[model samples]
Target: MIQRKIPSAEEAEKLKALGLAVINKEAEAVAALAGRINGNFAQACCHMLACEGRIVVTGMGKSGHIGGKIAATLASTGSPAFFVHPGEANHGDLGMITGKDVVLAMSNSGETAELLTILPIIKRLGVPLIALTGNPASNLAREADVHIDISVAHEACPLNLAPTSSTTATLAMGDALAVALLEARGFTELDFARSHPGGSLGRRLLLHISDIMHTGSEVPVVREQAQLRDALIEMTNKGLGMTAVVDARGRLTGIYTDGDLRRTLDREIDIHGCRVRDVMHTGCKTATPDMLAAQALQIMQENKINALLIVDRQQRLTGAINMHDLLRAGVV
Candidate 1:
C-alpha cells in the first residue's frame, strides 16, 4: 500500500477556495440560463399550463434525485407533477405517462443511457418533452421539443468530473420552472397550503376557530348575576381557566377568569355573595368561529389574553377558544 499524505491547513483552505469557485462558476451558469428564459421558457410554461394531464419528471442517478425534488416543488406550487425513475419507466412505470402529459428529463451529459432508453417511448406516447442538459447537441436535447441549456464552465470538483455544479444548475433551473409556473397560474399561498396540508403553512391557512374552539354546551358560561362561587364551578368544570358572564338573554355581559379571581381575592372581595358582574372584566377581546386560528393567536397575543369568547353578530356566545386550542391545532 502507498503512504498517503494528510492535507495541511493551507491545503484545506485551498480546497475551500476551489469549492467556492465552483459554486460561483455554477451560479454564473444559472444566471446565463436565466437570461435565456424568454419565448422558449414562456412556451414551456404555456405547454405545462395547458396540459390536461400531469407533468412527468424523469432522470437517472443524481439527476433522478434532482428530478424528484423538482416534481415535489412543482406539485406544491400549483403544477401537478411527479417523478418517474427512468430505470423503472421501462419496467412498468411508463403506464403513468399519457398523451396529455409532458416529460421533463434531466441529464448533465445529455446521454444518460437509462433516460435515452425512455425518450422514444415518451415520444411514441406523443408526450411533449422538455430536456435540461449541459450539452445542447446531445441526443436528449435533439429529440426534445424544448431544450433548456444548463451548460456550466467547469465542475466544482478538483478532478472536474463530479456532478456538483451540474446538479446545482439543474436544481436552479427546476426552481425557475416551478416559480414561473406558480406565477403564471396565479397560485396563492392558500392554494400552496392545500397541497401541503400536513405542514405548518397548512395549519395556519386551513385551520379555522370553529374547527378547534370549544363549542356547544362545552363553553364555560354563567349569568352575570350568578355568584362568584358558581362562576368558579363553571370554570372548573370547563377547565378553560375562564368563563363567559352573559345577561339573562344569553348575550355577552363580561368575562370572569382565574386572573379576575386572583385580583378579587387580593382586594378581599367575598366570593360567596359577590355577583360575577361585580368582578368580571368588561369589553374582553372576542373572536368569531370562522376566524383563522392564526388570527386568533394574533388576537390573543395582542390583548395578552389566553382565552377568547367566540360570539355571533348579536353578541350571543357561540363558542370559546383558548391558547390550548391554538396549541393543539399547531397554530402556536
Candidate 2:
C-alpha cells in the first residue's frame, strides 16, 4: 500500500489557503463571463438553434476535455451535440461533420494548430462556426461567424502556466449556452427524464405505480363480510403488512392494517369472530395506477404510512405497494 504522509499544522493551513485561493480565482473568472454574454453570445445561440443537424464541437488539449462535457450537456438538454477531437478531425474524422451541422470550436489561445488546420475544411462545408476562445483578436475567432470570449484575467495556477480559471470560465460559458437553449426550447423535466432514463432523476419522474405495484392475486385483499382472521391471513400471505377490505361488488370500502390489528387487540376484540368491515379504517389514502412512484413515495411519507392501495377512479382496488416495493424500485 502507498501510504500518504500527513501534513503538519502549518503545511495543512498553507494547503487550505492555496485551495481557497484557487476557488476564489476560478469563481471570479466565471463571474466575469456574465459580461461576455452579449451580442456575440446571442449570435452563437441563434446559429445553433437554427441548425437542423447536430452541434459538432471540436477542440484540442484541456479545451477538448471541456468541449466534450459541453457537448454532453447540450445533447442531454434538447440540443443535439457531439464532440470531435480537432487533431483527429485533421485525419479522417472530419467526415463526421455534415453541411447541416454547426461547428463549435474551443481554443484558449484562439490559435490551436490542430483546430486551425481544419478551419478551411469547416468553412468549405458552409456551416456556421461558433468559436469560444480567450483571444477574440486571433485567427480562429476572426474566421468564426460568432466569437464567444472566454478570456480570464489570470489562471488559478501559481505559475499561471496551467489551464485552471480559463477552463472553469469556459465550462461556465458552455453551461450558460446549454441552459439558455433549454429554456428557449421549453424543455421540461419529463424531457430531461427521457434523455436520462438510467439516472435517479429519471427513475423518480418516469416510474409509474402500475409499473411497480403488486397486482391481482399479489394484492392483499378481503371481503367486507370476511372474518378478521381471513384478512390477517391475506395480509400475511401477501406480505404487505396490510389488506384491502372490499364490498360484494369488489369496490374498496376500507383498509385493514397492522395498526388496526393493534387497536383491535387494545379493545380485546375477538379476532376470529370480528368482521373485517367492523374494524377496517374507511377512506384510506389511495393512488391511481398512472400516479408517479415519486408521488406515491411523497404520499406515504406525508401520511406516515408504509403501504398504499392502488385503485381505479371508481375506487376499485387494482394493485398495492409497500415501502419495500418502492425501495426495491429505487423510488425511495
Candidate 3:
C-alpha cells in the first residue's frame, strides 16, 4: 500500500528548508516562555507540592497527548501524576478525582467542553485547579486558581490551524513545573532510577560491580609463582580473556591478559618454565565490590583495558569483571 515519488535535488532542498522553518517557529514559541515564567508559575508548583494526593492531568485531542507525556515525566521525576482523558471524565472517570487531588487542565483555547463539564465535579471536592491555556479570560482559565499563560504568536503549520506552537509551549511549561517540584522535593538520581527500572537508566544507576561480576569458581585465578602455562590454562578454561595472578595467601599480585601473552610470545619464552610473576602486569586496573558498574566502566575506559578485578581492602581477589559481562548486564 506504499507509493514512492522521488524528488529532484531542488525539490529535496525545499522540503528540508520547510522542515527547518517549522522547527524554528516552535523553538521561538518555547523561548518566549522565559517572560511568562511569572508569579503564577511559582504558585502552580507550590499547589502541586502541597497536594497530599496525585496531580490529575486532563486535556482533549492534541492537548491530551502532551498531557500524557507531561504526566509521565512528573511521575518519574518525583511528583505523583497521571493523565485522565477529559472526554472520559464525565462518563465514569470522575469517581477517580477526589478532594485531595489537584487537577491540571490543558486546552489551547481554554474552552474545551469536555474539560469544562468536569469543573463542577472538581469544584464540589474543593480540589485546586491549575490551567495551561492561551486565553486568560476563557472560562477554564478564570475558574482555575492559577492560570499559566501558554499563548503563542502562531502555530508552526503553514495554514495556522494546527496545534504545533501551543502544544510545545504547554509541554515546556509542564517540564518547568516538574523540574521545580523535583528540586523542591530534593529528588535524587536514585529515586528517578527506581521509577524507571526497565531501561538503561535504571541499569546505570542501580547496578553494582557485585551484581554482575564473575565470582567464586567462575573467577579465572592463578598464583604468581605458578607456571605461565597454568595461567594460560585458567584463562582458556574461564574464557574471560584474562586471569588474576595472586600470591599463595590469595592476595592479588598482577594480571595476565591476552595482550600480555602476545607481548611475551615475541620473546619466545617457555610457558611451562616462566613464572606468571615474570610477565604479569603488576600495575593492572582493579575495581571494588561496592563501586557502581558504570564507575567500573569508567576505570576500564580510562585505563584503556577490557578486564577488571575486584578486591577487598586487603587486596584479596574476590571477583572478575570484563567488558562483555558489563555489556550482558546492560551496564555498558
Candidate 4:
C-alpha cells in the first residue's frame, strides 16, 4: 500500500488561509459589480434583446472559457446565443457573425490580438458590439457600441498576474446579463425545462405518469370478486408488488398488495375461499394519467404506499405505477 504524506499543522493552516483569502477577494469583486449595473449594462441588454439573430460571444484564453458558459446560460434562458472563439474567428470563423446578430466580446486587457484583428469586420457588419473588459480605456472598449466594465481591484493570485478575481467578476456579470434578459423575455421555468429535456429538472417537470406507467395489459389488476389467490397470481405476474382491484364496470374499488397478502397469511385466512375485496384496502390514493411523475412520487411518499393506480374522471383503471418504476424513470 502506498502511504500519503500529510501536511504539518502549520502548512495546513496556511493553505486554508490562502484559500479563504482567494474566496474573499473573488466575493468582493462580484459584490462590486452590483454597483456597475448602470446605464451601460442596460444599453448592452437592450442591444441583445433587440437582436434578430443569435448573441455571438467571443473571447480568448480564460475569457473564452467564461464566454462559452455565458453563451450557454443565455441560450438555455431563452436568448439564442453561442460562443465563437476569437482565434478561430480570425482563421475563417468570422463568417459566423451576421448583421442581425449581437456581438459580446470579452478580454481582461481589452487588447487580445486575435480579437482585435476581427474588430473591423464586426464593425462593417453593422451589428451592435458589446464589450466586457477590465480596461475601460482600451481600444476594444472605446470602439464598442456599449461597454460594461468588469474590472477588479485586485487579483487573488499572489503575483497579481493570473486571471482570478477578474474571471469571477466577468462570470458574475455574464450571469446578471443572462438573468436580466431572461426576466425581460418573460422566460419561465417551463421554458428552461423545454431546453433541458434530458436533465433532472426536465424529468421532474415534463414527465407525466402516462409516460412511465404500465398501461393496458401491463397493469396488474384483479376484479373485486376475484379470489385472493387470483389477486396474488396477478401481482406475481405483473411484478409491481400489488394489484388494483376493480368492480364489474372496470372502475377501481381498491388495491390488494403483497402487504395485504402477508396480513391475510398472519390472520390464517383462506386465500382460496376469501374474495380479494374482503382483504383489499379502499380509499386508496390515485393519480391521473396527466399528473407529473414527480407529483406521483410525492403522493406515494405522503401516503406511505409503494404503488399507485392511475384513473380517469370515470375512475376506470387505466395504468399502474410503483416506487421501483419511479426509480427506473429517474423520478425518484
lDDT of 3 at 255: 94
Query: Whole-model lDDT for model 1 versus the true structure?
Result: 0.91
lDDT tens digits by residue: candidate 1, 1-332: 99999899999999889778876877776777766687777878888999999999999998999999999999989899999999998899999999999999999999999988888788899878999899989999999999888888787676888888889889998999999999999999899889889999999999999999898889999998898999999999999999999999999989999999999999999899899999999999998988889999999999899999999989999999999989888988
Window of ten residues with lowest summed lDDT in model 1: 29-38
Q: Which candidate gets the maximum TM-score versus the true structure?
A: 2
Pitting candidate 1 against candidate 3, the one with the higher TM-score is 3
How many clashes (backbone atoms < 3 Å, residues ≥3 apart in a chain or on different chains) does model 3 have? 0
As a whole number from 0 to 100, the lDDT of residue 100 in candidate 3 is 94
The C-alpha local distance difference test score for the whole of candidate 2 amounts to: 0.95
Question: 1-332 in candidate 4: lDDT tens per residue?
Answer: 99998999999999999999999999999999988999999999999999999999999999999999999999999999999999889889999998899999999999999989999999999999999999999999999999999999999998999999999999999999999999999999889989999998898889999999999899999888889889899999989999999999999999988898889899999989999999998999999999999999999999899999999999999999999999998887
lDDT of candidate 3? 0.94
lDDT, each prediction? 0.91, 0.95, 0.94, 0.95
Order of quality (TM-score): 2, 4, 3, 1
lDDT of 3 at 107: 96
lDDT, model 2, position 143: 98
Taking every candidate in turn, the Cα RMSD to the unseen true structure, in Å, is: 3.6, 1.3, 2.1, 2.0
Instruction: Note the residue pairs that clash in candidate 3.
Output: none
lDDT string, candidate 3, 186-299, tens digits:
999899999998999899999999999999999999987889999999999999999999989999989999999999999899878999999999978898999999999999
